[model samples]
Structure formats: structure tokens, C-alpha cells
Target: MPANLTADFLKARNEFRAAKDRHDKLVALEKMLATIPKHKGTDHMQADIKRRIAKLKEETQGKSSHRKGPQLDHIEREGAGQVVLLGPPNSGKSSLLAALTNAHPEVAEYPYSTVLPLPGMMRFEDVPIQLVDLPPMSAEYSESWLYSLVRHADLCLLTLDGSLQAEELANTVEEIILLLEEHHIRLVRRKEITEEEMRVRDVPCRIVLTRGDLGDLASRVEELSDLFPVIVTSPIDRTGLDALREGVFVALDVIRVYTKLPGKPADMVEPYVLPVGSTALDAVRMVHRDFVDRLKYIRVWGSGRFDGQQVPSTHLLADRDIIEIHLS
Candidate 1:
């Protein structure tokens, strides 16, 4: 299929090639992406443009542009899911990351302490969730790669200073929203984006207030609840960290199902994870697509009406459920 390239896109591509500075290059690339037609023929071109835009933004916004920020910025998702941290500078992202995971991202009082995407595994119960501390977002500095990262992420945690007054908190949120909107990113409180959101790139996100011990955060928390689901935390006391971990797991919207041979015990240690509300057939498909053809019926153990009861393939599986399949 022909790309059916537009004249505006051609001009923008030329401008992008001629642009010298990182910021200007990013602008031109975005223009090119916007002008390009969205279709199968242009998918590869769109991806290439996005990749270049991400690399340029990483080099320009991050303080460690001298390093390999461009290549190192794209982190593959691991563990149960990937959750990216979004916030302006001095929002205690590094401190929270250090406290939650073994990864130590430079924790400092100054702004722009973290200049790269730091990945760490955070344990919730027995499951691990990958949490990435990304470069700070502000009106003046924002990595273009950040939007794509969040769009691909299972969840997003927007951290803000809990000590800020009501006005400051509002202003900070406005700044974060404005910057993300500028990149055509929107944050919704839903775990799954609707079909209408595909065009806008709406992402599921929750607000996290760090340093809650700094001031009277109770009132602020109560006020913010009407707007967004908020979680308060303090790195010093480990307060709300557990809740935050659980919250992240919940945001992932996944269920763990253990499978067993007809006569053996279920593999409880490493349960197969699937999206919530997945049916027994869906679970079978995860274990092996071929099972879909051989599967007759699965016997449910946990979370079933009766222990060791047989359930239909369409039966919905809940978290921590165990299944024993009997093939004909």
C-alpha cells in the first residue's frame, strides 16, 4: 500500500533533517508525525519518527546527555508489569524508588537529580512489579520518550510533594498535565482505556503524594480525592509504601492462576498470570496454545463453588485460583 504521503509531512521531514538543536528536531519530528496519515502503510514511518523523537528528547532533557541516555532510555517490561513514575523535580521520586526497590537513584534535595530511566523490581506479596524512575517533567524539560513509555506501561504513578499547599499542588498538577497534553498524552483513572482512547493515547494513572510528613497533608489528600485517587507516602517512615505496592498490583488488573497435572499438585510457586476476568480457556491458551484444542474441561479448586469441582471452559478464574485439567 502506498503511504499517500502528504505535502505537509514532506516539509516537516525536511525541516526535521535540517534542524540542528535537539528541541527543534523534536518539534519537527512531532509535526511530521502529526501530518503523516495514520494507516498500515505509514506504521513503520511513524515508529521511526517516534524513535528519533524519543532519542532527541532524552538527550536534550536529561542532564546526562553525554552518556547513553538515548539507547538506555527504552526499557523492556519485566516482572508482573511495568509502572513508570511521572512528576516534576523534587517530588521525592528517587527517595521513593530507593526505599521501595534495591536500585539506588541519586537522592538529592536539588531538582533534576535523576537524569535517566532507573528500573527496579518492587515486591508485592510474592509478585514483582517493575518500577521505573524516569526523568522529571516540567514546562521547560520533558523527555519525548516519556509519553511512549507511559502509553506502553501497565500503570503510571504521578508523584507530587505532599507538603505543598493546596494552590501549589494544583499548580504542580497543572504543569504536569500541560506537559503531557502537549505530547498528546492524557491520564485517566481507569485501568483499561476504551476504544475511543486509542486516538488520544489515554493512559491509566494514579497520583502519589510523597513526603506526607512535611505538613498537614490530610486536608490536601481529602481534597484531591474528589479529583483523582490519591495515595500519601513518606519515605522516612515507610508509611503508605505497602499500600502503594498493593495499589500498583491492583492497577495491573491481573489474576494469578496455578495449573496442575491431573494427579499432581498445582505449581503454586509460579502461577500463570493473566488479565482479570480471563476464562479457563484463556488460561489454557497461556500455558500452551495447543492445549486449547486438547482441553476438555478443567476442575477448579480455589475460589470455586465446590472444591475439586469441574467447571466449563468459559468459567471465569479469579486470583489465586487453582485448576486441574482433564483431557479426553
Candidate 2:
């Protein structure tokens, strides 16, 4: 492994990380495979990339083979957000998902056990963040779906083996990042920088160690904390679960808003609340984008600083505020 070749490998990896779309990832993966020098040092990387390409091809074919499901229709729900869980086999992901939400994914003690993605709605302070438990990444499993999910995820909870050694942990994280990069998903390594400095590059990741009560796992947890937000807990101990839930909400970057109308106060028709970044016009646009253009006046009440204020349709709304729109 020449130093330059190693550098090229890293560069190609980053190119894959920053890729925007599926086509981009495929192109970057091909380039990454081409850039790595065909030597003993890169032999493993080359093989892994070839495997990834083949998997991607299979997925592309699979998509055409199956009819699209109704879930494809985009409908924003009250406080709805999406977070995906990524970890090695038997890292307590199924347990964590069961602990956090109503989702009853099959919990077992084996590798590649979760064959499909399980989505569950989790409530956190008037907001609902959808948590998905994905299949484990292993030598025997395809990493393609995991990569795709991580790229689209608002946040990622990287699970660690509570019984693994420090060197083993490092190696696992390195490989996870490599898969993420190979799929062109951007991630910021928590090591080598400060949290405030971390904001410069927007990579959403948190390190969570399951079964942390094991003696001396603190140091292992500490080691992972250097590169990402680290949370340690055992299912039995139940520590850090609240922090973990809050972290998911923070990652979604949403705020809640309530609805209000005089006589129809209790007539909540649909999506009763919305996320913070949502605009007054967003509501109208959501109903129909044409409403956004025709929106004339908005009467807002409750929950916001400016209660009972009549503002323009473009007025930015705050959490718990009630809004009544009047369109042209």
C-alpha cells in the first residue's frame, strides 16, 4: 500500500460520501474501484466495492420486479420525522426499537435476523419521529439497503457491541464509514474536531453503546465519544434512554404547531400539528400548491408569542400556535 494509493482510496471514499443521488453513488463507486491501485493493500477494498456494485445492480433489478407500494405518496403527518438505526448484528437494535416505540420487530440473538425495515411511530413531546430498524450489515448481508437508508435518514444511531474490544470497535466504525462512503452518504467523523467545529460539516450521527453496565466499557464508550455523540446504556439498567430519544428529535430539526378555528376547534380534519420549519404557506401548499399562490390572510391564535394576531399567509409559525387561513 503506497501512501499515495491510500490517499487516493480515502479521496474516492469521500467522493462517494458527497454524491447526491443514486446515479451519483453508482458513478462514484465505479470511480473508487478504478482509483484504488491493484495491490495487496487495496485488494480488500477492491473486492468489497465489487460486491457493493453487484448488490446495487440486484437492487435496481428488484425495484423493477416489484410494484410500488402506497407508502410512496408523500403525506406529512403531525410531528412526523424519520430516523434510521444502523448497527452490527445483535447490537440490541431490535431491543432498542421495542423499548422506544410500539414497533414489535422480531427480537432474536443471531446475525442477519432482521430481514426487512421496520418502521414505528415514536412520540416525543407532541412530536412523532418515525424510527426504522434496518437489517444488520455483515459479511453475509448486502450493505446496499443500509447505505440507501442512511443517506436518506435525518439521523443515524450507530450501535456498538458492548462486549467488543477497543481495536475491534475502531475497526467496525471504520468499515461502517467505508460502506456509507461507498454509497455516497456524507458523514463527519467525530474524532479530530470539536462539537462546535462539527457544525461546519453537517453529518448527523450519534454513537450508542448497548449493555454499557459491563465493567470498563466506560473507556470504550469514551473512545467512541471522541468522534460522535455517545450514549451508553444497558436494557436492564435503562439509563440514557431519555437522552437517546431527545437526540432523535433534535436531529429531525422540527417544532410542533397546534390548530385553531372558532366553531370548528374540535373538527381536526387532518395532520393536526406540523413541524417547526413548516411555513404558513406550506400548509396551504400541502393542501394544494395553488392555495399557496392564492392565500390571502392568516388568522393565528394561541401557542405563539403573537397570540390572536392576523398576519399575512407568509407569516412564519411557531410551535403550539393555532392558525386559520383565509384564501383568495
Candidate 3:
């Protein structure tokens, strides 16, 4: 018989796959074990999960005693989602990060100034999105762990120097794509994944034309706009920063849902972030997994025919929707 995995189990498994830090991975594994169907078919899987959890616990204890230099291999994700900036040396990754986020990466006139990943929270209206500025991706100073960062990113921003001629900029972009492809990472503009491309990781990407004030980039932007969403930005003049933030949020494809008690006012601040098309059931699960079983129904203030209209658990949510959960 097949293992007959459940939706909750599959969601936990995906979390495990996407987890970079050991603590997050262990939590996901525990959830997987908890949600997986208990049957003869899943006996081996259960045993494997148990063994991995044991090993992780051992490693976690050992790490406290024999900690070495700071490991930059993994960055704990923060805010809504992680967006990694990639490009050749002096492609303005550092400058862009400094301008957009609070991160103070060393922005210099020379190449290879950034040696590690620097992350900062960039607030877009009400949401805080993480922006990580990594070391430049070039033959001269690319880090081996850069591929892992890009592979796990929610969205990748390919920064290109707008001052370079259109042909040179295009060649640089091609080289960057080829280098990532060698590591089994295919950059795509869309979020949809297909079965045939399961072997390679498809990371959604956007093109950022930096140094927009330096040269006439109309033709350059026109050329690359056909392939990817192009955002021409100049950190000096603060041009296109707002548009970039909006674009990044759109690329992440998430919705914010506000929660309210049955008789209380809605908490407008810090809306719970969920992926697009997430249902009322998903929101309840996010609010508290224990509420799933006790969930009676939901009432919606937005995205409903009438205010405070009763909605079923399967009701799809929209951006800025206010939901009040009714539990048994």
C-alpha cells in the first residue's frame, strides 16, 4: 500500500525541503512525523524521521560546545520572504541594498567589496520584506555557497549596470544565467513549476537596471523587458525604489489577512501573511493548528457579498481581507 500522505504532511515536507537552518528543519520534520498517516506502509518513513531527529538533536548539542567561526552558509529567513540580490562584480548590489534597506554594506567604487551576505528589512507599506545583499557572482570572487542562497530565495533580483552598453549588459546577464544553470538552478519569471523540470530548481527572477541616471537606458530596458520584469533604479536619486518594492511584493504573490475577535475590532497592524489563494481553513491553521478541528465557520468583513457575512472554511481569501474565526 502507498504511504497515503496527507496535505498537512506534504506541507510540512515542503517546509523541510525549504528549511536552511537546523532548527527550522527539525521543527518541520517533527510536524511531518506528527501529520503523516500511521500505517504499515509508512513504518520505514517514520523510523527514518525519528533517526534524523535524533541526529539533529545530537548535532545541536554538539554545536554549542565546539562552535567554530561564523558559518555564513545559511541565513535565517526573516520578514515576509527572502529576496537575494545577484550580479557580476560592481553591479550595484551593495548600493541597492543600502538604499532600499537599512543594511550598510560596504559600497565602494571597486569590485568584490562585499564578502558576506548582509540582510535588512525593507518595509513596503505595511509588510516587511527581507532583502539580502550577497557577494558578487563573478568568476573572480563568487562564493561556493552562493548557489544555495539563490536556490532557496523566494525571488532573485539580477542587478545589471545600466551604464554598460546594451550588448555588454546582455552578455553579462547571459553569463550569469549560464553560471547558475551549471549549478542546476534555472531562473524563471513565473512561479509555476512543472514535473519535467523537477530535477532543477526554478527561482523566480527580476531584472534590476542599476545606475539608471548614468546613461540612456531606454533601449536597454526595452531589450531586456521582453525577457523579464525590468526595473530601472538609481539609488543616488532614489528613483524607482518604490516601484521596486511593489514589484518584489507582487513577485512574492502573497496576501495579508487581518484577524479580529468575534466582537472586538480588527487588529489592522501586522496582518497574517499567506500565499495567494489560501482559504479560510488555511488562515485558521495559520492562526492556530488546534483551531482546525474545532473550526465551526468564518465571517468576513471583506471579499464577501455583505459585511460580516458567514463564510465557509473553503472560502478563498483576498488581499486585506478581515476574517473572524468561530470555533467550537
Best by the lDDT measure: 3
Q: Give lDDT tens digits, candidate 3, residues 1-328.
A: 6777888987897678556578988999999899989998777778878987897798788855565776576687888889999999989999999998888889999988999989988988899999999888975557998898998789999998898888888888888888999988998998774432334679899999999878678999988877788999999998899999999999998999999998899999898888887898888888888999998889998899998999988899999999999988
**Off by more than 4 A, model 3:** 1-67, 196-198
Q: Among all windows of ten consecutive residues in candidate 2, which has the lowest summed lDDT? A: 190-199
Window of ten residues with lowest summed lDDT in model 1: 191-200
Winning model by TM-score: 3
Q: Provide the clash count, candidate 2.
A: 4
Error of 3 at 13 (Å): 4.3
lDDT tens readout by residue for model 1, 215-263: 6688878767765689999999888999999998888888888888877
Write the candidate numbers in order of decreasing lDDT.
3, 1, 2
Q: Please, what is the TM-score per model?
A: 0.77, 0.63, 0.85
Candidate with more favorable, higher lDDT: 2 or 3: 3
State residue 111's C-alpha deviation in candidate 2, in Å: 2.6
In candidate 2, stretches whose alpha carbon ends up further than 4 angstroms from where it belongs are 1-63, 66-79, 139-141, 163-167, 188-203, 213-218, 263-276, 287-294, 301-305
